[model samples]
Target: MSHSLSMPASCRASLRTSFAMSGALVATALLLPLTAHADQQSSETPAASGETASYDTTDESPRSAYLSDWYNQNVTVIGSKDIRFGPQKIDDIYLEYEFFGRKGPLDLYGYIDMPKFFGIGNAADSGAFDGGSPIFAEIKPRLSLNELSGRDLSLGPISEWYLAANWIYDWGHNSDNRQNTLYTGLGTDIDTGSPLGMSFNFYGKYQWENYGAENENSWDGYRAQLEYNYPLASFDNGASLFYAGFTNYDFGSDLGDGDSTRTNEAVVATNAFVYSFTHLRFLAVARYFHNGGQWNDGSELNFGDGDFRVRSTGWGYYLGVGWQF
Candidate 1:
């Protein structure tokens, strides 16, 4: 268990909330489709005179268009360490259900995870079935401005713009530990001209029920996030390797309430390597935290047994295996 520092904020006592969605590991695939049936082959028909005639189906329309344009779902088993939630550093194994895709003009990503569900964790952890937060989930959705407006809004390297939103929830036992947060703002994808893919988002945060922190029920902060991905290699057996990562900067918060141990800014960056096939996937991530969860690094706190230095700035890691469906 983490030692507590002096604070009037109940959140600092046992904060377990996590920014799960911002750390989503999925990378979007960009498909530039010009004409829908451009790849279809022409069919041959026998004529009355026994000659063959060929006809193209390019003029034909799709029999049906699905509301969910494209999607992928997976169940992942993840082992993570030193994921800061406040003053505490969490280490646990979790089961997660993650999904991402596009539907009409909306792009989406989401996940629901059960922390410590397998009964493996540090002393600070509580199993999902053993009084811990039963579920933690985050959902992110972005509406495409170009698709909605029926116009080419592309400007040079920027391919698209979006109205984006992110929502997070942790189902703790009571109000004191539960967290609800929402971020809304703008997002955009950039065309890098090579194999690299990139996206950026800026958001204003709305805090709610944040473990009784002083910033709860208020607009407390802003976050800027950048995501990137590139394909590394491919195999003849249909397996592929890739690199993906994201960086998040959170600032402008009053959660510290004047405490030096807590601050208004935090930074988290992740680097991931993935190997994926038709039905199986594996990934490893190295994530760095600076003032993680806004808890100041190198700050001294008394865990009731004297003074201990907080190591909020460090590297954390995650290893996961998943099955795609």
Candidate 2:
């Protein structure tokens, strides 16, 4: 009995030691990535360096400043959907959600961002614009329809190469309407947050000839941009500012009558407001995009059947507030 009792104590000691070793190994394992990110966040770009870093916080919520990325890496599948609210406008309403699983040095995730929904003013089909007007009386059912989108691996902590595309066509809610768009791209993370950590994204979108056939609006274009983020103390939220310059090269013969290359420049003012109840975040963004050699004044405004169909420069902007999980 004495010998058996001694063996149990020995086994317990071995188990305890194993657990201790396991903990130390885990802590050691976590150290590498943390150092990697700090190296980016703590310093500015070296005079000899070229680009910023690509990485987000991976620690789960209940986040603290000590947590890497400040816990921005969402292990949950969170995203949003949006649609046009009126004619002459490209935004309507949006939504978001999230999912979970964890991988090594990375978290598994998925998301969606849609920008169109149904409404009585023929939101999805017509060039219906409120024209800075107000609706006094309403008797119809305010219509609404949601859209779906897959995750954009274009920018995240654990993304490799990303590819995405979307095309939309709906005529049920209005008349003489045609619209289609396609988008896809590749990106990488550059961890240079120190002096000016910026990320690079090269994406292309093919918007078809809408309500016109002169190839007046068909083009294969890509946007190359850099973004910078800053954390402010005012709201327990981070305030990030960014600027992106985009260009599109036309493919069809419309260039014969107009410009062939289109350019867009934009600046961003942003803040992600976290809520106390549902734990969801509200993202407020303001951006201004200018289309070089593009006219948005005719029936063919941006894609309308107007005179500026040939690549000409035009300008517009949007202030949006949406949520993410």
Candidate 3:
């Protein structure tokens, strides 16, 4: 049966609210390629002989101390469906403009997405021209603590520390369809002593306008994230095969209202494979969501006709073709 027809009206409304607030995660999938590329390139760049290591003295160095900078911009088409996080699943296809870079003390990543760009989705979807939110964007920035303090705070196996923040915004026509969220905390890059690169971050979440969800306008949960990137292979033509991914675990949130349908914890993990070159790229991603959007798995929502079981745990897939600039 169609989710639109089978879902109770109230549950449907809650589902919309949850999906609107959580849509920022969709933009997150766009981050892997650029992040992996930037890190890989920076790591492979040759350093000058006798260069002062970043972990040297506590003296405040110039803004260009490290002297390595890299960035990439790309546009991609992405599609996914049947990944549940609410009363039903949301199917969406979006056009994405993404950018990421590292310069001086800053590491930054961001993207903008136009949902339903191809006018393909289920009834729950709001097309770009339709009443749904037209644009969703997310920005993540990390400032090196070592750079800012002019000190090398690297511990064993930890190469760098950062003050990291993420902000998400959805430009919808009304407050009920809009979302604004922030995550702030500490982050670090790990030294694996091999080709594999890893990063970890922990954040406290603050919710602003969450599509009228109960958690709106308050401090909500905490999230722990881990990311990894590896260069699987490189070709003579400069095209390369790369593997990258991230995992997020969210906990300690109280959405108010206290409905049995929702929980305080959720998790999502994603893996990506990219075949990239200077001018073009191809990407495939697989993701797993458990208790997505904090919706309880196997919980029943009772309405007029019968009870419907929520399906919030499952696998989601994304495919994209991109042009790098």
**Best lDDT among the predictions, by candidate number:** 3
Q: Per-prediction count of colliding residue pairs?
A: 0, 45, 0
RMSD of 1: 11.2
User: In model 3, which regions exceed 4 Å deviation?
Assistant: 1-28, 34-69, 301-308
Q: Which of the two, 1 or 2, has more TM-score?
A: 1
Error of 2 at 175 (Å): 11
Q: Model 2, range 235-285, lDDT digits (tens) per residue?
A: 112222222122223223232254323223322211122211112222322
CA RMSD per model (angstroms): 11.2, 19.5, 10.9
Writing each residue's lDDT as its tens digit, candidate 3 over 127-193 gives 5688777787777777889899999899999888988787878887889778888999988877788
lDDT of each: 0.60, 0.23, 0.61
In candidate 1, what are the lDDT values of residues 236-321, reduced to their tens digit? Answer: 44455656667779998886667888889898776667665544667777777798878888888885777777888888777778
Give every collision pair in model 1: none
RMSD (Cα, Å) of candidate 3? 10.9
Give all TM-scores, in the order shown: 0.79, 0.37, 0.78
Q: How do the candidates rank by TM-score, highest first? A: 1, 3, 2
